[model samples]
Target: MTKESTPNDVTLAEPIEQEVEAHSEDNKVSEQEKKKFEKREKERKHLVSKLAQGNMDHLLTRVASVLNHYQETRNSDITLQTRYWEVFQSDIYNGSVIDPKDMYKLERLTSIARARAKIQNEFKMFLADEEVQVSRRSRQETEKEIQLATKPEIPLISMYCDESGKTGNFAIVGSLWVINKARQTQVRDHFSKWKTEKGLSAKDEFHFTEMKKHQLDLYKEFFDEVIKNSDALGFKAVVVDKTKIKRPIDEIIMDLHYQVVHQGIEHEVSNGRLALPRIVNFFKDEEDGQEALYETKLKQHLHSQFRLAFDDQLTLDLFNSVPSFQNVYIQMADLYTGCISRVLNHPKQGEGNHKDHFAEYVLELLRLDLGAKNDQSQDFAMVHFFE
Candidate 1:
């Protein structure tokens, strides 16, 4: 049934075979091109992923870009329809092609991505602006410190002190600070002028205990000067309850004095009320009843403490024991501390007398509550009670 091929039949079959071979070669080239395209696409996706790593702002921006591109292309009905048909023709989508519902979701996601990217950019800009502001503030602060450091010498401030009620239920130690030489001169001159006007001699003592009932108005007038000069003056006190003494009162008194002084200076400097590297001149009411070497020991101890706290930056310029009657500022310290001690220990000592009324007046002026410990940041006053 099969016939043998002749020479003419063989020649015709040869062209057909050659055509088949050419078609096969063409298919091989097409397959190679397809592989190359797929590889390029994979590389591009890897590159995008690499660029987006560890940078949320960049990642969000890239996602927004891709979403925006798709949304723009899908906006045209012709392009949308063509892509839809193409997807159906290919096996990439299988039987589940993205429908109108999915396209609507894709649009919503694109809008959200764009919003997120905008917010990320704004937030990044906000953080950058904050860093710049912080840097500027730091520079200004550094310049201020440099200016303070370049002064020829540290500013000298004086502290006058007094203690009262040492033998009573509460021992009160109070101090007044004249922060500069000008303020010191102003306060002393004012006191001297006021005394001269009142027909009082330079040797007259303004002891709170000796004040009579008729002298209440004069005392109030004197205190008015104190309140007026509050800007250049500061006050601090430490009260120790005699009933709670574990250590000797003498030892505790020395430590408490140091505490009040050191803490007051530290607080003022830190709050920008006082500058650093100050020279403090300390003067206390002479303790004639104490041991002969008490003043010397206290001075040594205070200097040692200052050296530890501030090294050589802060210096104890002078330490002396002076008579309270000779110095109006020391008398002022005495009056303030005496009032506080009397109120806390014996509020009824001179009830209905000028002393009681004056004590009440002092309390009102300073805004101090006797029973509760008072220490506030806004005011340069502290009354700490060690129970």
Candidate 2:
């Protein structure tokens, strides 16, 4: 038997029933949100585990490298880690962040900072245990490597190389070093202007072999301009006497070329003309009919030398071979190398011929008398006769 409800009871039950339904709906929403949060937490933990185990993604690795460089270079007590973490805490949690990406980056970088600190502390402990000796130079080199790997900018110098007398009594490798892009432009402009005045187009390349008696004055003037701009221009040459080579020329030519470039850089660094942490871009005149990739081999040789030579941190960038006719700098290298080769290879043709006169004039300008071996330290120029 059911009792019939009164109107007053119905009104009271209506309000209570609506409240219960609303409460149930709220509980459902809360449960769904909880599941979503749990999934996100699980994913985050997996990501963190991966990062902790040295499975850093590219972004993490890059950020870690950058932080490492800052630690090495910046002398501060607070550290980038502390400053960045404070910002992360204040801005991210407050929801006052400008970009959402900042949230993830700040968190990741802070983690990297922590990891780096831990690794360094452990390394110190390891060194103590092993009684290892780390020289100041080694530490500086490591810092340089970090900077080179992570920094956005670096100082650059261009080296234009050309070979001469490869088949003759003496093989000479000459290179013209231009400091920075501004100097490269300045040199090109000056050379172009001189060529225009001499009724020559951009296509008219300068070569020692092409020099005539009539062009001696022009050639002298050209070299004079070069000497005048000695601050921006440097010349280095390595002359190898073929008589001393026990092996085939091809077997040793690469090394000879490498020595010329390497010693040239060393000389500049020693003289304080070029500073450290520099990259050299090497451009060589194209070799005719050689099956070997000369530029690639030269680049590899240079890399190996830098890797083995503890003293040098100088890096090599673009090692390209281009036509001598296309580049004025390479042509200049050719002219210089050719002059040395002619003087050294054919001693009998010393004074009478135009080539001899021009070579002699160049040697005089360099303040070097023609000899079997000569080196000029003045005016940012060096010529070495390899023993």
Candidate topping TM-score: 2
| Candidate 2, run of 10 with poorest lDDT | 123-132
**Clashes in predicted model 1:** 0
On a 0 to 100 scale, what is the lDDT of residue 62 in model 2?
Answer: 30
What clash pairs does model 1 have? none
Q: What shift in Å separates residue 272 of candidate 1 from its native position after superposition?
A: 2.9
* CA lDDT, candidate 1, residue 3: 97
In candidate 2, list every pair of residues with a backbone clash. none
- Summarize candidate 1's per-residue lDDT along 1-387 as a digit string, tens digits: 999989999999999999999999999999998887687655444432322111123434333222222222212223223233332233333234666644543323444434433432432211113443345245355454344333344566678888877678887788888775446656677778889999988888777888888888988888887888888788888887778887787787787778778777876786677887776767787766877587778888899998998888677755666666547778888788878877877766535678878887976788887756455333766677666
Q: lDDT of model 1 at residue 75?
A: 23
